[model samples]
Target: MTAAPVRLTARALLLDMDGTLVNSDAVVERCFSRWAERNGLDPAEVLAVAHGRQGHATMALLLPDRPAELNLADNERILAEERADTEGVVPVPGAAAFLASLTGLPHALVTSADLPLARIRMTAAGLPMPSVLVTAESVGASKPDPEGFLKGAADLGFAPADCLAFEDSGAGIAAAKAAGVRVVGVGPRALPHHPDAHADTLTTVTVTAAPDGLLTVTVG
Candidate 1:
């Protein structure tokens, strides 16, 4: 016999763009591949730690000796390059309906992409943008720091524990947990991190809002 899905309740939901709601892996890999070649680093190695982080943060980790200014500059260039390319950008399976289900509910987007990059990619994927957002520029630190997730909860006027986060990376899961928010792991990248709930895609998750303003999220 198979076990039942995990059920969680929260006042709001926090969404991660890349890998979670939006499939931007092709653009991410292409841009990172070019950056790696420019830095004389292996593309595969660079990509290993690139997801779930701001470009500068990823660069700082990969090249600890590099100057901060250089990383920041490279991050800007890469963001522009990423925004310019959307060939393979698209919504993750069931992302459209998932967002639709959250309409009129409290939710916020928490992503490592800057607003411009987020806009382009979201538009490319044909996903609607959330009214509340915590972009790369919104936080002083990137994923694994918890700053973004904390701010995302605050932006929605909810305590961290009152909100649930959906994430698709180890760094994102760590950040949400550190912020005291429970999480539902989305997609393959999130499995190893062991979020409070797990689903292969948003297709398996359902949300129902209560009269008292709580949301029950059931995952299968």
Candidate 2:
């Protein structure tokens, strides 16, 4: 059964990067594919475990037989290319309007992306730079561990239970729940995960825009 829609009364919103705020599938696939080919690894295998995971973690999983040094090096290389390559990236529909409506809302970005890739992907997606972002480098543990979401909540100066998380991946959903935050899953695949709320897209949700450009978004 699906959880109830998340209400927005907290001081913050922790949004995931890929699939949630933006769709960077092509770019992500290309980066991983290219890196895998260069390293004599299978592109499909690499990509199979890439989504919703940090670069370092992906490297460990994909190139497990490789030396730690090699994995570290390749992770860095992949990160660099991803940061420089943002083609075809764009914000998920209604993301901009949703962000615009919450003019004074205290929200933060929390993603598995590292600093550079986060900035690059977000910019390519045409999303404004959030005042605060919790990326891979900031957390000792990644998604599914709840560290990223919990850190994001802490950064926003709010209790985890008081915050709402927007996520697209199963791992991200697990992380949010582990952090004690309600979650809204975006897109179709996310629905089966039984998020607190589900939407076809950010566009499907309603947000009231005031004359001053402020927005009040209602969930569920």
Best by lDDT: 1
Model 2: per-residue lDDT, tens digit, 1-220?
9546544445467889899988998888999898888878899988766777887677877666768787778778888888878888989998888777555677888999888888887778788878888998999987778999989999988889878888888778988999999888988657878898888789866555455533344665
Give the TM-score (vs. native) of candidate 2: 0.84
> What value of lDDT does candidate 2 attain over all alpha carbons?
0.80
After superposing candidate 1 on the true structure, give the runs of residues whose Cα lies further than 4 Å from its correct spot. Answer: none
- Predicted candidate 1 versus true structure: per-residue lDDT over 72-171, tens digit per residue: 9999999989989999999999999999999999999999999999999899999999999999989999998999999999999999999999999999
Clashing pairs in 2: 101-215
Superposed model 2: Cα runs more than 4 Å off: 1-11, 38-42, 63-66, 207-220
- Which residue pairs collide, candidate 1? none
Best by TM-score: 1
* Overall lDDT per candidate, in order of appearance: 0.95, 0.80
Candidate 1, residue 176: the lDDT equals 96
Worst lDDT run of 10 residues, candidate 2, spans 208-217
